[model samples]
Target: MTWLRALREIVRSGLTIERTRLEPLVALRAAAGVAIVIGLALWLVSPAYAASSALGAFSAGAATFQRSWRPRKVIALAAGAGLALSTFLGYLAAGHLVTFLLLLATWSFVAGMAWAVGPTAGIVSAATVAGMLVIITLPTSVGQALEHAAVIALGGVVQATLILLFPIRRWGAHRDALADALAAVADYARRLSHDPTAPFDAKPMMTARSAAAVTPSQARRRPAALHGPRGLAERIRPAVAALADPRVGAPAEGPGRDRAREVLGAAADVLDAAARSIRRGTPAQVPSGAMETLRIDEGDEVLEGPARQAAVRLASLLGEVLETADSCDTHVVPAPARGAADAPPLLRPTMFRLVPVVLRAMRRELHRDSPVLRHAVRLATVACLGYALGTALPLGHGYWAPIASVMVMRPDFHQTYARAVARFTGTLVGVALATGVVQLAHPDAYLSGGLAVVSAALSYLLMRTGYVASQSFTAAYVVFLLGMGGEAWDQTVRDRVLLTLVGGALAVVAYVVFPAWETPRLLDRLADWLAANGRYAAAVVRGYGDPAGQRRADVRQALLASRDANAAWGEAFGRAKQEPVRHRGLTRREAEDAQEAVQSLGQAAMLLETHLPERGARPVPEAARFAEALEADTAQAAREVRARRNPDWDRVEEALDAWEGADSGMDPVVRRGAELQLQALEELATAVDRTPLERDVASSRQERHARAEEEEESRRERDTGPAPPPKEEG
Candidate 1:
């Protein structure tokens, strides 16, 4: 990408508004928490102290609204504590410029690294950096600083207390995650009737699993409905895929295909009903009518072989789903159990015990190539340099400079650049609004406080709508906050605007110096996804060859690993597309094609998973050898892919040919399925090896050939009148 194009993209992305449903009530509630803190502080101390308290309360409440799985109150409390601590430390060091800058650098770096934990943690920590810069300057003495810090902590306390008193949809995120998982499966089932090769989205399931990881305290209060259905959905995916697949379960046409379609539709209905029940925390009564299709009648044509087994399994699981998705207040239903040898349960430690866990996660990102590590280095450098430059310039707005840098810079290239552009735009608008208010109406203290609250409320409501909107309100809130404290905002707004531009410039330039572009990581991510997909596919295929020795738990773990790798590659690919770096080895078209190939590889494995034979059933004689070869070949292919070399699947072909030459003894069904797996592997190899030049040449030749054929057909039509329409494929 050229610099001009990149700049245009950054500006466009920065200004793009997201269309999210407005939740006025939630925003109002959080605003009320800020208002309460402000009102109390004004009644007791003064507006200056009230501004500090409001900053703390508003920041805490904002953090709670971020994408966190924990209870909102817990997030509020954690944010408050972090803000209080940073506030206290920042003030203590503020007495010396050298000391404060060093501390600021360290704090900013830690805040950047916090992203390794999650977005919620990372964002809350960034808020702390802002609080340290903006909120700490109010205190004059050490004693006053301590008092102000306590007030900031109190602000968080008020927000948490308000949330506890009037909660809005408790465990709402968790419910949505689980409901979405079930809904995705339902949608997949529906599509399978018409498109047998429909691929399942792993994102919803991944989200549900993340939501299921609960601290002991959370586990105690978690609803019964959220516990059991996720596991069932995971198990049902393979069964449904198998039943719809022509090679494995049902015939391509005839009575069996019709039965498969009917079973799929019925499964979709039941899953949808269960989803609604779980989401609403209602009784599972909605499935009563739709559940009958799951029952095998005396004359039903669909009840036979693997299709019959899958239908029966689906019915049994739906029964479990109905049994679990209800308003059961008796005892919380236990989460599904796995074999002792399976992966550990999704248990989270108490928040107090999360320090080590977070540290370990951060530690893992300490490597040179880690984006989180590079972001930390970039953040620290920009923050410190921005502060020095801001202080040295005519506009000595310490908070404005560093806060702009801290808020705009993200771990990814696109966001960092986009946010820097957005930050400047938002700052200008916000500062202009503040300046207008000052010039037009010099509101009294109470009115200024009210205006600040209103501004904050607007920010909360629009946080997810766009970076520009929320950031504008946030900037205006700070101005109004200072205005409430008897500050001369007319001149201050101009200074802040200048410093904001400087800060944004610093952030953008810093990224270029300490770059962490996703382009370089794409190959690594692709290799990882390829290897993981191989292992997962191999595991599923091996189960058919060695059913007695197969561990379902191992297969399940492999599937999870593959999904994780797929997600990682997807994230990198998305970021890489937006980045302005040179393409590394693989072009954009090749990357996309390779992704599709890997997806097909996983989809084929999913189909195989649906038909693993019982232990006593006969296994294909050469299946084990073929599966072993596939595993080794794909692993090697992954290594080659990382080096930008075409993968050789000669070993895989040899194994398949050997199986084919000797498969006179194997069942035709299993034999055909193995061939399907081989075909998917070959497609993956072709996808990875084909160059853009080759594809373009091939397409051009095909288009010319097609035109010549069309001319010949037209000539025939002129000579023989309109030819009969070609018959459609059966």
Candidate 2:
């Protein structure tokens, strides 16, 4: 019954689907591309060639359209060449049993390795494998193969030409990415306005940051003058958070609170307007009276001390946001500020490089006991095995098995199992539907071709929604595609269903036998995150008293590393939770607490970085000393996490208490920033301390209960008498 429940859970998870607003547009683009290719092939060539050409065009265009211009050109050419090469190889290997098997296995292995290059290369490689299967199954001579390959290549050319000629949605993705980042910032500000203590959700902002960061850096292209919106958002986040800090004394009630709320609300409106303008490529019109709301009177008695400080900080950040939005709206880069050259380079090329640095990364992974290398090898092995089994068995359309295997297997056990279930179930439904359509309607070549185009478009549209919907459309597309190419649907439907089941089973078996379980790796991932945060905190603290003109490149690097580490830990933890109860290394509560601690540490570091006073501002020696002490304490906490021991917060707490009494005689803004940073550090330390303490308490309680049970058992045995055991032995 337990096993049944687990299976039911897996099925439910696999079936769950989601759709985004962009689906209709994506579907339309894909459908139009395929439809045009099919129309051209039907007009200029035979129906048999039309099917193969349309398939090639659809796959290549779907993969390349969203990329930048240069990459799109490269992908289009590479994908077309891959298709041609695969078709040629298929013709040369057909009917020769040994040669055919060897060719398929070798291609499968190469395709698996192509994933190490990058996603675009991986997509093209998979498309090539599909092309090979299609061409190999049909009888062809050298001349006929050449003609077929040319038509397929021509199809790719058509897609690329359309992109060049139409130019619709140019830079639309980039615009949307930046818009989303601004909108996320506005959302955060609104939340802060309502309750300074409101839980901050950083996931949306992080996702938008990642998207905006993906723009390719090319020497020939004019760089977008301003840094990504993420930088602006990061600079603003701490100020918003500081407004809610009780230590900052940002008025919890009365007229001051109302004024703060009004400012935040108005700022949010301006940000929303900016995002809308960027997305629509129009001039940004600041909301009426928003600038007026941001204006702070110098001598307002009600806004004294911390409230005054918060209002000033909020006004400054809002001004920066407005300037950035105006720059984006006008399509003009802002002039470099005085001493801009001396400022730290915040937007580095490491993340935005056009050519991926994956090869060097893969090489490094191969030198260690890396899960990436293990997964790659496993994928290649499984792909070859699936191909050999399908070919050796008496299954018709044997290529489907290997394709299914390649599509279903992932680096992690969780995804592999989930995808296997989804793929098999989707295949069953798709085959039944396709089979029924063929039997009832007896569709001709033209109808079948149109149906194939529609299904292909739908598959690409729902690709991100989940595996099941995408697979269902894909299976239906394949059925219609083969039918249009003169294969009877009746004969292919059963083979598709059986082959998918076999492939899914093979994928599951492969992972079960040699799983890369995330449970054992969870601790290491968490430790890495802690170490990264520690380094980030240290860098920010060390630079707090540095020359105002100095660049903090180290801080930026550490922040990026910490973000990457956090993401890695989150992925590993999520997979670990989905494993069986006995296999889970940490409880859900323990993981969540640790995650919160790491996030708090990151927030503290950001606060310290932003708190550093500008040139000519008063410096607080006490603040600098406190920051250094906090840095050392954070490092110690990281070491403790690595050692799987409780963090010692006693010394850190004492330092914080001592700092509270020390008078720095600094400006209110600097003092408030320092207070917020110190408070955040304390929160982080407390959260870190709670994890091991809770675990110890739970352990002690369990031990006491066990001891009580043993005592009860002894009493029961004494009452029953020991003579019964001896009598049984005699």
Candidate 3:
């Protein structure tokens, strides 16, 4: 029995190992490098090491192949290949170790620059360039080196081939799982639209929305990952981007479709909320009829237990959706009614008048002495200094400069400093390990190859975990290359340790100088976001429901822009928090209000899309009035934080509610448009204050359904000829 249990465990372990696919490929490629190392030790280096390195590199390439169907992924992979090849040629041309190191450092800078565009491209570029440079510059005979390079190329080819061979079953599963999750979220959105009792907390909504965004990615590359959260975000990144686009919000046309869309949006919000609540140790509940409104599909079956449970929990939140109609303060709030103190000082010459004051204020806020600017300056300086010191160092072989640069640069003081320390420590440890292995094994070709393979495998595992792991793995490869270069393990270890420290120190010094504050940039982004949303809201309010094609396109673009702005705003504010107040261009409360206003606009746009067509043909009087009221409300909301005394939220809500409810009479197009617009506005308002109107909407739906069922029963009874309906047995 014990033996059987042990055998089962062994099989499972092997299966797991095989599943990763990176391990074996790493080991194989490492052997190629190992052969060179052994030959260098014996002065009879073989070409086999090149093949091994190629294979290892190729396997590393395969790791990213998991994201292969995506164009972005393909582009990233291609860029990495190009960068590595370019770095190698540069190293070959220079021949001098110092020159090679400089080229490698340049490669690192390029990689960092690319990172601002995309993460995958940046990492791949960094890794390939660093690796190739090490291989090209390392000590080896011409014949042996050529053969090794060939083998390495072969490895890359094989890795790419392997990626294409098997059907990736995980792709569909991931997609389906994501879809199910989104569907659950949609259910919650629907409840919130009608039910005013919904919790509708912003944090939870954000969280759930974030989670829902992961589906498109999962649908694309479902890697054969045994159920775990590892690499989940990376896989779903693209899908998240797509979901943020509002044009995709086209509601199904026909009866209940508008209602369904409202439901879906609210459900999405609820799912977002529940996901958040779950993190905070409580789960949100769904309202009654939440699930009934959503279009459930078999794709939902793809979710495993946890995802299913999450969906169920999210559904429960719908039951508790807010009933906010009663909270509507049916009062008209005057527009632009500012107090004397609330007004900005009159500018005699406009731009010139405020220029001096603005400049003085900005100088005081964004001074070089400010912590935020100081941090940015330090980050850039550290990167530059790391490069300079690495160029000066007598580091034997490879691109120490680039490696040092990556280790030294950071988003902030702690990260920059911490990375440098980690890099130094990891390098020293790696060198020591390499030296010990060389001494104990006596540099036999087989043994060296084995060690190389082991290092590659370890690197693949460590890369995703964090930079420290990657740093150590890089050191192991460096040692292997040095061995191939005919350097003794002890000398290689000593040189590596010293140069790493030098590079690290230089990077640290650079970071402390000329820090660039990002606070102003964040504010600028927020302002841009606000302006874009304002335009979108204006377009929607003015032209709801009419010519479908052009208007839809405009509204869709606006919606997408608004979502992008929200995302950008969130990221900007999050980063700004690390900086001092002086560096922050916008006040915290002001920023919050801006986000809220944009969100309200989004809701308003949705409402117009829904109700405008139905009510558009009605008497132009009320519609025109509603438009004016909406515009006024929006302007007020935009400047809400800047007001001397906070305006009445209740009055704002009431005006929006009343405007949304105004009848356009029996015109279906106008009625639907109005209803949709109203529903959307109500939701946005309810977000701030749980209005009873939402609840009334939900109850009305229930009554309508009941009445519908009753009518059907009565018709059936009449058709059956009434007397025969009674039980004959009685």
Q: Give the alpha carbon lDDT tens digit for every residue of 405-521 in model 1.
A: 888889987787778887788888887887788678888777788889999998998777666777788888888888888787775887898889888888888888889988987
- Candidate 3, residue 143: the lDDT equals 55
Model 2 C-alpha lDDT per residue in residues 1-730, reported as the tens digit of each score: 2546756876775566665433566466656777887877777877788887877777666666433324354566567778878878877887686787678667765665565654555556767876787666553678888888887787778767766666665556656766777788788779878876555555655655544443234322322323334566666666666555444545666666677787778778877876776677666788799888877887665555655665677667666655555555444344443222233333324333624565565466563456655666666667668777888889777778877877777667777777888889888887788788888988887888888888887777766665677778888887887888888987788888898888888888887776777887776788788778777776665554443543567777787788788878988887787765332344466677767766766765665565555555555555456556656776676677656665554444455456545665565454444444444444444444445666565455446435644664576478676533322244
Tell me the lDDT of candidate 1.
0.81
Tens digits of per-residue lDDT for model 3, 1-730: 2435533443333223333334344334333333333334234435345434543343345345323223222332353345346534653645565665455555544544433323444445445544554455543555555555544544444444444543333233233333344344444344543442232222322333333333333323322121221112211221221112122222223322343343446455544443333322233444555456443345644222222332333333333321111111212211211120122211122222534654454355455445433533443344344545555666653246545655455444444555666677668767777877777777754455556556755765554444455556657756764464345677677667776776666655565454444456654565456455555655565553233323545655665566666676676666555444343225565556545654554544543443333333424434444445555554454454223222232343354445443554433333233333434333423333223664465446446535654664586577676533212233
- RMSD (Å) per prediction: 6.6, 12.8, 17.7
Clashing pairs in 2: none
Best by lDDT: 1
Give lDDT: candidate 1, residue 522: 88
What Cα-based lDDT does every candidate model obtain?
Answer: 0.81, 0.66, 0.44
Clashes of each: 0, 0, 81
lDDT of 3 at 171: 34
